[model samples]
Target: MELGTSLEKRKVPNMLKRILQYDVQLTKKFVDLALRTTTLKSLRNHAKLFEVSCHGIVWLACWLSFIWLFNNKELYQLQVNMFIALILDIVVIAVIKAFVRRRRPVPMNKLMELGPDKFSFPSGHTSRAVLVAFILICLNPISIIFYPPLLAWVTAVSISRVLQERHYLLDVVCGAGVGLLEGLFMALIWFSQSASASILSSLSDEKLDGGEYHV
Candidate 1:
């Protein structure tokens, strides 16, 4: 209800809004061109391939192993950043899940035919896709190579939610917002921690020098 109301209140041009609605609906019905949500199907497939798959544990572990082999400082920074981001992702996802309890499309409108009728208002699958993609892109500028496939997968994930009667357009949009913020805030947290460590190390060096540098 809140998601729908917020979307209704947006200041979109009438024609564009109508066009968008039609596009979304048309995309939803095209089973031949897309995959709909199914725990045993689309979502699971992404979990196998997408970064941050399997609740992000797989992504983190894989990144760590790769980083250890490559030993790049910049990659290390991003790993730290995404580590923070994943934590924020968990916090935001948990809070939203509890606060905005909306039924899935199937329950809200019985006539809607789809699969995976569960949880609305911030699709978890969308959240995972967005956060993982955000982190991967930021970690390496060349990660742009993954852009097309990553974006396609994210689009597919969002479409699956709608087609599967699991979420509304608004839910997916807001979930993307939350996921993006998760990466941003996580980067901030990493910078702060990195700064603190630097400061602490500097103080230790000073102490070891007997309080001052001996020229």
Candidate 2:
């Protein structure tokens, strides 16, 4: 029994190592193919557009700007929740990236200079894309017609990460999974309209008067 248990323990790690090596090689092949197929500068630039659209900083700025401009209660609540979701997404991503510390498939020295951390086990952009899409679909804040386009955006964002050599295939796959879990968590602990409003009001140091804002 002791011998059998020792062998089983040894085999499990070896199996995991083999799987990791295979994943790396496969991701390299896909990245190489993408580079060859998208040799054109314009094509590469277009893929970058998809990447930038789903960047964490861009999402944060856009959501905050929308909240500042729109006062509709429904819109306000949605924006506030989204803002909170983004923060949660950032915290989760940061924690995982720090712990994993995996290198990007392609070394981006310039990009690395822009950010302190260079780990890329899970694609943040892909996670953000999936999270946003899931939230929109679940909430149905916009017309049903928008869901298809939202899904397309998520697909594009995910593919763009691999094509750009910013992340491995497994990184993106796991990122989507993480994003789904985060969305489900957000749904479970979602704030009510009044709660959202009160939180925002407190942050801005504004008072509510007779169930209305007076600032």
Ten contiguous residues with the weakest lDDT in model 1: 47-56
Model 1 over residues 1-215: C-alpha lDDT tens digits?
99999767655788966865774565345532344435435653443243234344565577556534543334445545555566667667767877765555542346554444345667766787788787667743445667998888887666556545556666778788887877676555556446534443453554333346555
- Root mean square deviation (Cα) for candidate 2: 5.9
Model 2 per-residue lDDT tens digits across residues 1-215: 99999667655466767876887899777766666674533344577789779989998998887777666666657877899899999999999998777777654334622245578878889889988988888853677899889998898888877766678788999999999999999998888889988887776543233244565
Measured over all alpha carbons after superposition, the RMSD of each candidate to the real structure, in angstroms, is: 9.3, 5.9
Best-fitting candidate, measured by lDDT? Answer: 2
Would you give me the overall lDDT of model 2? 0.78
What TM-score does candidate 1 reach? 0.54
Model 1 / residue 139 / CA error / Å: 5.9
